[model samples]
Target: MFSLLRSATAFLIATASLAQGYSNPGACSGACWAHDPSIIQRTSDNLYFKFNTGSGIEIATASSLSGPWTLTGYALPSGSKIDLAGNTDLWAPDVHKVGDLYYMYYAVSTSGSQTSAIGLATSSTMDVGSWTDLGATGVASSPSKVYNAIDPNLIAVGSSYYLNFGSFWHDIYQVQMSSDAKTPSGTSVNIEYDATGTHPCEGSYMFYYSGYYYLLWSHGICCGYDTTKPATGDEYKIMMCRSTSATGGFVDQSGVACTSSGGTTLLASHGTTYGPGVFTDSSKGLVLYYHYADTDVGLGDGSYLFGWNVLGWSNGWPTV
Candidate 1:
């Protein structure tokens, strides 16, 4: 009865927050099905584009936040140059602008396997046919490699670039990138790891705000929802750590070292929202754009939808 009461209270709080119009994601229309969404606004036109996991990195565009979005098509219509068996479907795209060009780092691998690679593609203009595939970044993992390489995110600090990618085997790892930000230039650094419950964590996005660099990633089970799903609260949620240096020494709110599996829950299952992965955008006051499974729409992974919320800050930490 106590557990039931706690759950009911949590549900009410979540519902109230949504009704107040602050916590609920902005209304999205048109092609809303997306997973591992990475969003950015084109500076020239201020148009919103979201690249997500798909066969060739599916893209969607919208005029504004609350709008009828349109599926623009794939970034790589011909699939990736990566030739791993059963890796035709690309996954976990992270896009950022370097100088005047847009760089998209994606994953090439099948589910639950260590034989994976992080591939790169660049575009002068982020149009359907503008992308040029650059193939693998030499950041790959085989059965012998300790860490599985997937879910790539690049962060540029001053004149240096770092790529954060990893999953399952060792949670989250980082590697230095060359000036072009396309290939790894340094050895791997283990930044964050969660040893609890299958070590399920990936989709890391690093952002700099104020004076601290925030490392955010998705934790818990993220897929296989069509056939089986984790228990309510045990499903996917957003977790975060922050550091003064972009390379290492990250910690949670309580100052526990992130490399030792310390993480603060940034967002979790609330109301109808479940299993969210985030992309931070500065166009709208440090908003978090992500994909979540709407309980009302069924539990299938294919039923995931795009969502976003303008983040608030309290005591130098981000709030929901």
Candidate 2:
């Protein structure tokens, strides 16, 4: 009995160590399903944080990139209402910090309609309860305008600001914001239209990398589980291209064009991986954060969680 007890204690210690291994970055393997990963790094402490799509804006973060993550908190408060009816299609949530204040951008619309619009909120803290919605923008800031406005993200170049967004109704467009990060400042520039497929390209995430502004988007259908099986092309891949300007005519480095129904694939269904969001890590450089649609955990239905991989540039083109 004494020997058995000692052996059991040893096993428990090993288990604890294994579980705690992810406390160090680059210690774990194969956790790729992060959708629209918006990353923020606190320069003061030199720690990076990830906020992406999951069960009601689920948030899991690690001390560093390679992590055994700890679930910090949801992006939304415990009972916050995204939709009036509480439909909970909390698709893409982008979180970034400006000075001491943190801002979150996200979408709220049910499947199969142009009724969706992207909304914004701000908080000084990471806890979900602190955020306050600034309202939606698409067509005249109308909450019910219904032109499929979602996935609003920010691009700041000095005093000028740009808001990028789009959905099924049309192509992704960007309008300058008034430096204050509030109202529109100029006419909207139409970026990419009807990207490379029947479905309207959505989830437009923009970041400057390698001296060019890259627009990474997910083309093809996403998230419809009314039926037991999802259709082909429902959710599969990610494609990207870049341009010299903040608002493109963005193209791949090879001069391959990124237009409606046509852009280069950064990632496509691989062992379950799908739809990627691009971010430039200060230390890790370029990183692709996305989801794997058919993983066993969510049954491949795009009930997405977070996964990430380091990105590298090869022969002037970006690859995972």
Candidate 3:
């Protein structure tokens, strides 16, 4: 009995260490089907809105972070002008409000191919018919391109703005944006890359907390739903790095550069949850929202529920 107790204690300690600083808050119900979700809180009425990858870029609204979310409508019902590449299915959206207008950056790609383009759309109000598609941002990927132009995220630091994007081929890249937040101005710079794996990292979201710019991204195979999962047990994990400057010099906890294959695992396949997207929740502080295959809800049927957790800070790093 004593030996068994010691073994169990050791197992618990190991599990705790693997979790890092995050804890699963619970599953979100009612219109929770979301992948590559980007969240923003509207200041007009303080309502929370989440945009996701889907046919027309799915939109979900809630009053609070702990949501009784409802799928109201899609940002683009008629699909984007670049509908040939994205078809009706778009991927990985990043939404941010600039001044009185809201800007949404989304990925348009031909399924598995790297032929992709990042497009811009704007809305005065985040309603269904309010959004106006501004066409592509001139950032695109071709067969000869080394970087995949998808998963666009706009990071605003002070007066300057940067659009961070890329996937698969070379991972993440960033470029300084015009004041309008729609056009890329300066030269695009490589931000993060993993020299190993099929698709090392994607879905880059940069958050400025305390004095550091924390770069959070998803690593490993994503979007198998329930039909497939990562055999290496590394799929859809949230990886993180930090730097004082928003542009470059990001490093993991071990002081390893992000330009290398260095990233500290922030969240991984804990139980059924996977594919975490970190965002700031106005009411709940820092929140990590992801998708999970709930065994209780029938696993292999592609019924991945929404999963979320409030992140805590320890030693200037984010914890769940």
Candidate lDDT values, in order? 0.76, 0.55, 0.71
- Please say which candidate is ahead in TM-score: 1 or 2: 1
Q: Which regions in candidate 3 have their CA more than 4 angstroms from the true location?
A: 1-22, 298-301
Candidate number achieving the greatest lDDT relative to the actual structure: 1
Q: Per-residue lDDT tens digits of candidate 1, residues 11-81? A: 11121124423476678988887777777777688777878787888988888755688988899988899
Q: Write the per-residue lDDT of candidate 3 for residues 191-252, one digit (tens) a residue.
A: 89899866567778787877888887777766654566456455566788999999999999
Evaluate residue 116 in candidate 3 and report its C-alpha lDDT on the 0 to 100 scale.
Answer: 89
Could you estimate the TM-score for every candidate?
Answer: 0.91, 0.76, 0.89
Worst 10 residues of 3 by lDDT: 1-10
Give candidate 3's total backbone clashes. Answer: 4
Model 1, CA-based lDDT? 0.76
TM-score of 1: 0.91
